[model samples]
Target chain A: MANTTESNLPGDDVLEEPVPAMQQLLDNPFLLLFIGIAVPTVLYTIWGVMEIVNLPIAK
Target chain B: MAVNRNFRTCPTTGLVFHEPAEKLMRWNAVVAVVALLVGGVLAIGVLLTRWQAVHLLQADLFYQFLTAHGLNMLVFWIIFFEMAILYFASSTLLRCRLATPALAWAGFWLMVVGALLNNYAVLRGDSSVMFTSYAPMGAHPTFYAGLILFAVGALIACFVFFGTLVVAKAERTYHGSVPLVTFGAITAAIIAVFTIATGAIILIPTLLWSLGLIEHIDSLMYRTIWWGFGHSSQQINVAAHVSVWYAGAAVVFGAKPMSEKVSRTAFLLYIFFLQLASAHHLLADPGLTSNWKIFNTSYAMYLAVLASMVHGLTVPGSIEVAQRLKGYNNGLFEWLRRAPWGNAPFVAVFISIVGFGFLGGISGVMMGTEQLNLIIHNTLYVPGHFHATVVIGTTLAFMGLTYFLIPVLFRRKVAFGNMATWQAYIFGISMSGFSVFMMGAGTLGAPRRHWDISFAGNPFGYEFPATAWLMIALMGIFGVGALVGGAMYLAITVYSVFLGEKIQTPDFATVSAKRGMAPAPQPVAVGATGHGAGVGAWGMVAPGTFVLALVFLTSFVLYYFVNWKYLSTVWPLK
Candidate 1:
C-alpha cells in the first residue's frame, strides 16, 4: 500500500533521485533548529546591552 | 518529478516534509523561541515593577521595558510561530512542496530583521509610547519602519500559504475536501492578510508623519484605525490558536469534531465577525457615536463570541466521544480522568480551553458592554483579560505543539523530562492567578500603565485601599512562577534540539507518532439499526462534555449579572 501510494505521487521519478550527502547534513532538522535558536539568543543579548547604553535616562 | 525529489517521508507518521519547507519551519520556530525568551525576561522586570512593594525599575526604564515586552511577546513570538504552523499545514499535511520556498525564506529574514529593528528603536528610550504608539506622541522613524517591514513580511508569508493551498488543489493532494486542520489554517491566513493590510494602511502614514513628511496626525484617527490592526491581530491569534486546539485534539487523542459542518461554519463566522470586536477599544472614545458602538460591541461581536462558544463545546465534546469509544465509560468525568495527563500536548489543550472560556471569554463580554467599558477601560483589567486569551489560550497551545515537534521534526529525545512534565501546569496556573489578581486590583481602581501605582510624591495622591497593593503583590509572585515555567520550556526545548539523544523514528517514549499528520479518523456510527451498538445510542457518547458545558454556561451567566449589579452600585438610579 505504501509503495503504491509513493508510485502514485505527482512527481515520483524526480523524488526518487538521491541527493549529495553534504546537502543532506546541512538540511538536517536539528542543525537548522540550532542555528535558528542560537543566532537570535546571542544577538538579542548584545542588543539588550546596546539598549541600556542608548537610553541611559528615560524622558 | 522535481516534487518527488524534494520531499522525504517520515517513516513513523508517513507525512511528507518538503526539504525547503521543513528548513523554513525550523528557522521560524527557532526564532519564535528566541522572541519568547526576550519577552519572558522583560516580563519578570515589568511584573516586579508593577508590584508596589518591589517596584524594581525606575519610571523611565519601566516604560521602555513595558514597550519592548508587549511587541516582542504579542507580535513577534506569536506571528513567527503561526507562520511556521502555516507552512506545516499547507506543505506537510497536503503532501506537496511549498509554493515558493525562496520567497518564504525572504519573508523569514524580513520578519527577523524587522523585529530586531523594532526592538532597537524601543531600547533607544525615545519610543516609550507603549504598544499603542498613538499619534502626536511620536517615536523615531525607525519604529514605524520596523513595523512596516514586519507587516509586509507577514503579508508575503500569508500569500505563500494561500499559494500552497492552490498547489494542493491543482495537484489533487487529497481526494475531495481538505482536512479540517488545513481549513482552519486557511481561516488564519485569510484573517492574517486582512490584519497585515490594515497594519500597512495605518502604519505607513504614521511612519511618514514621524519623519516630518506630514503634519498634525489626529490622535482619534490613529486610535480608531490602529485598533483595526492591533486588536484584529489578536483575532488572527484566536483563529490560529483555536485551530491548534482542534489539531492537537486530532493528533493526541485521534479525535474528530462532533459535527464537522457546525465547526466549519463557526470558522466561517469568524471571518465575517471576529474583527468587529476591535470596536471594544474605541467604545470609550467620544469621536464614535453611541449607535455605532452599540451595534459593533453587542450585535456583531456577540456572533463572534458565539463562534468561540461553539468551538469551546465541540473540541472537548469530540475528545469525550473518542474516549467513550475507548471504553472509559464510567461516569461524568472518567473519560477526562483517564485522559493522557502525562502528555504535554493534551495538558496544554485542556488547560487552554478552560482558561480561555472561563477567564478570557467572560471578562471579554463584560468589558465590551457600553457601560462596563467605562469601568475598566484603561485599568489593569484590560491587560489581565488579554493575558487569559493570548498567553493561556494561544501561547500555551503553541508550547504544547512544540513538545510534539521536538522529537518528530527535530528527531531528538526531550531533555529534562520532569521539568517538561510540569512546565504547562506551572505556567498555566500562575498565569491564571496573575489574571485574577490583576483584575482584582483593577477593580479596586488601580490604573494600567502607571509607573507607580501608589503615585508617590504627587500633590494629589489617592490611596487605593490596602488590598489593591496586596493583590498587586500576589500578581508579582505568580508572575515570577510563570516566568520560571516559561524559562523551563525554553531550556528544555533548546537543550533537546541541540544536545539530546538523536532518534531515527518518531515513536520514542516521549513522543507518539501513531496517527501523525494523517487525516482524522471518521467517528464510529453509534446508532446503527442492525447491530447491538444501537443499544448505547447517541446520548451516551459525550455526556461528560455536555455536563462541563452546562457548568460553563452557568458560570458565565452569574458573572455577567454580577458585573451589572456592580455597575448599578457605582451609579444608583437618579
Candidate 2:
C-alpha cells in the first residue's frame, strides 16, 4: 500500500485563477451533458456501420 | 519558450519542469492515439465485411482483423486510457504525486505487452471467436497468450491505482474523506481487479489447453467465467463515467456536488454491487436457469442501477445547489439557463450523462428484462444499446476531459478553437444520430453483423425490420460527419501540443456554476509542486522503448512456450 502526503506547494490556498476570454469560450459545460445524451444515441446506431460496410457495393 | 522562461521549476527538485497535468495529458493523448488507430482499423474492417467488400482478404484474415479490433480498440485502448484518466483524478486533482510510479510503469507495460500479443495472435489467423471469445471456438495458442498477458497487465494497473490512493490518504492530501470523483475511480479500480481475475481464470486454462498441456477446458465453464469478466469490465466504464461527471462539474461550476459524503458513499456502492450484476447479460441465454436469470437480471441488476441512480439524482441535485449559490436565481429554470453553455468539459459531462440516462439506461433496462431480451438478443439493437452506454456515455466524457488535460496537465496549448468545438459536436451528434437510427431500425428488426440485409422477402415476414437497413445506411451519412470530426479533433490536439501558443495560468480557477455557460474569466493553470524529492529532469527518454520491450517479451516467451507444447505434447483429440 502506498502512503499519502499533504502538498506544501504554492497556491494551495490561493483563490482559483480567473478564466481568460479564450478559456471562457473553450469551457463548454453543455458538451459534457451532450455526451451523456449521445451515448445511447450512438449505441442504438451501431447497426449503421454494419449497413454501410456490409452493402454489396459494385466496386 | 526557453527564452520566455515559459517552464516552471519544481520546488522539490529545483529543476525546470512541465506541469504534472501536462504530463498526464500527454499520456492521455498517446493513449487516445493508440485507441483511435486500433479502433479505426477494426471499424473499417467490420464495414468492409458487413458490406461484403473485402477486396483481397480471405475469411480467416477477415475474422482475425475483427478479433484484433474488438480486443485492441474496445478492451486495450479503453482500459489504458481509463487508467490515465484515473491517475489524473487521483493524484493531479488532489495535488499529490503518484505513490508508486514503478508499479504504474509495470501496469502500463503489462497492458502494452498484452495488447501486442493479442493483436499479433489475431493477425496470425489464431483468434477469431469474437471479443466475447465464446468457448470451443478456440484460436491459435498465441490468442490465449495475448489474452492472459493483457488480463495480467490490467490487474497490475488496478493495484497501481490502489497504491496512489493509499499514498494520498497517508499524506493527508485530502481533508476528511476522498473527493467524490477519486472515490468513484477507486471503486472502479477495485472492480477491475475482480473483473480481470475472472478473465484470467478462463483464459489461462484455455491457454493451457491450446498448448496441449490439458485435454480441454470445459466450454461451458469458460463461457460462464469469461462473461464474469466481460460484463463486469463494462461496469468499470460506468464507474469512470461517473467520475468524469464530478470532475467536469468542478471545472465548470466552481461548485462541488452537494453532500460530498453521499457522493463518496455512492461510489463505494458501485464496488459492492457492480461485479455481481453480470448476470444481466446472460438473461436471454438458454442454458442458465430461468430463476437464475431472473434473480440476476432483475433483482441483482437493480442494486447496481440503484447505485447509479443515487449518483444520477445527487450530481444534478448538487449542480442545482451550486448554480443557486452562484446566484443564478431567476427561478429554478434560471439556474439551468445561466449555466455555462460554452465550457467544453461541462457540456461533455452533461451530454454524457443524458446519453447514459435516456438511451443507455433505457436500453439497459429493456435488455435486462427476461422477456424483452428475446427480441433484441442478436439484432443490431444490442450493439446500439452498448454504444449508447459505453461509447457515447463513457468515451465522450473522457474526450471532454482531455480538453482540460491539454492546458492543465501537459502545459501544451490546444491547436484550434472553433475546429475543436465543432469536432466535438460533430462527433457527438453523428454518433447520437447513428445510435438512435440503429435502435429505431432494430425495433423494426434489423439483425446485427449480417453481411447482406437485402433478403428476398422480409426475414421476419411482415414483422421484419427490413427498413432498419435503409436507416442504417442513412445513418452512415452522420458517421462520415463523425469521422471527419474525429480527424479534426486529432489534428487540433496535435497542433496544440506541438505548435499552439504557449501561455501559463496559475492553477485553480472558478467559473459560473451553470451548464453550457462560458467562464466569467480566462481558464486558470492549476498545477502542483512536489513536497519531497522530485524527478524533474528534462530527459529525452523514448516512451516507445517501453512499448517495444513489452512486445519483445510477449513474442519471445509466448513462442517458446507454444513450441514446447507443440513438440513435446500429443493432442488429446481423436
TM-score of 1: 0.87
Docking class of 2: incorrect
Task: Compose the digit string of candidate 1's lDDT tens values, residues B294-340.
Answer: 76678778888999999999899888777766777677888789999
Q: Which ten residues in a row have the lowest lDDT in candidate 1 chain B?
A: B527-536
Which CAPRI category fits model 1?
A: incorrect
Fnat per candidate:
0.00, 0.00
> Against the hidden reference, what TM-scores do the models get?
0.87, 0.74
| CA lDDT, candidate 2, residue B115 | 75
What local lDDT does model 2 show for residue B188? Answer: 73
Task: For residue B458, give model 1's deviation from the true position in Å.
Answer: 1.8
Q: How many clashes (backbone atoms < 3 Å, residues ≥3 apart in a chain or on different chains) does model 2 have? A: 85
Candidate 2 TM-score to native:
0.74
